[model samples]
Target: MSIAGQAVGLFAVTNVDDLLVLALFFGRGSDRRATWAVVAGQYLGFALILAAAVAAAFGASFLPSGVLPYLGLLPLALGVRAAVQAWRHPVDDEQPAERGGPRVLEVAAVTFANGGDNIGVYVPVFATAGPAGTTGYVAVFLVLVAVWLAAGRHLATRPAIARTLSRWGHVLLPLVLLGLGLAILLEGGAFGW
Candidate 1:
């Protein structure tokens, strides 16, 4: 796939968690700044994790041959889990305000908290994508992050949307996670798992 396509796919898979976090963290502030801070922190955290994976690969391969697909499956599983949760326990009308400022540190913490699966998947992608593919890969990832931030900002501003999302957010998570995980698993296998 082209860089654009890859980024879109990755972003779509990863955006759910970011969206959820943003909803959870919705507070009175500049949505634009908060979005950038959160999204940038996430992408930066992902990049760092990829770097660490590269370093580890140089010494001992942490991911097995079949690991990439499994990593991809994470999102699918998470999505399903969220959906189930939502079905079982619906969201309440009252939504809590976000607790922190757009401090770089806070953003980084939120990013890290939400980036576990992203980092896991990145390990394989970084290990596999050679020098020729790195630029495109990075580009795609960044664009996706930017797009996600934009969407998140919009969502943050819309109280009705936020309320609705919160009411069904738990349910949505599981389905989205499951789909993303399955897509990654399949894509990895098709490409060369």
Candidate 2:
């Protein structure tokens, strides 16, 4: 695929769940500052994820290929943590003011936790891309992140959609994270056990 195509594809595929998470955050009626915090947090988290992918791509020469597959454990562990947290706190009843409507760290943590696919997809693209292509992919991804946030924010204002997401989003989120982690393990051939 062309660099642009690859970037778009990766952004679309990796961010499907983020849209829901963002909507859930926004549905809580967070103040503008808090909402922007979520955006900033997501950017920070995504930057970290991309940096790791780029590092892995560049450092592939130094590491044994088998060791790279084991990196899948990171997301698997994150998924398990999220699932446990959800199980313990089944209801999200905290007021927006009380918890500040998705703190930056919370959003960042969730973004990173749910980023197994982002890393998996980005590493291969970064590996194939020349410097110019890598730059193009990064640019595309950054722009799309803004587009995604806007879409999620807009979705949050829709009554039916927001209600549906608020109702079932938490339940689905853990499952999605678990699935993403399992997929990474299986796809990377890290499931030798």
Candidate 3:
């Protein structure tokens, strides 16, 4: 796949749950300032996740070549864990009540809290991507964040859509994560890559 295509897949797979969370926030957002703050918070939180992944990738570059393929296990384990969690606790339609107006920090905290899986998937991918590929992935991912926010906001009032997402997101996420893990493993040992 092309870099943009890969980025889109990675971002979408990882952020399916984020759509619901953002939709919830957007649903409650009456103030322009809070809305923009949520957008800014999303960017800030995602940027931090990307940065940490990049840093880990950089560090991983120094490791032995044989160790690279093993990195795939991280996402695989996460996928299994997520699948088990979803099986154990099925999603309900209960939505979060809007507290007061959410600030940048509050939204950022939420965004960051929700990003553990992103960091796990990104680090191994970035580690293999090298400099230019990493740049392309980051650029595409950042652009997609705005698109995701817009889509979420647009879907906010649609209860049917939200309900569908709540119903299926858990199942879809584990599948995506499992596929990503398999891809990484299959494409592993691309030494010159």
Q: Between candidates 1 and 2, which one is better according to TM-score?
A: 2
Put down candidate 2 lDDT per residue, 1-193, tens digits, no spaces: 7778878887998788788777766654457986888798788878776777777777754434465556556556655865686677666555221222556765676676566567767777788886678889889998998998899888977878766556655555456556756665676677585
lDDT accuracy of residue 97 in candidate 1: 30
Work out the TM-score per prediction. 0.54, 0.69, 0.62
Clashes counted in candidate 1 amount to: 18
For TM-score, candidate 1 versus 3, the one ahead is 3
lDDT of 1 by residue, 113-148 (tens): 345456555556666776556556666776666666
Error of 3 at 149 (Å): 0.5
Q: lDDT of each model, Cα atoms only?
A: 0.55, 0.69, 0.69
Leading candidate by TM-score = 2
Clash pairs, candidate 3, are none
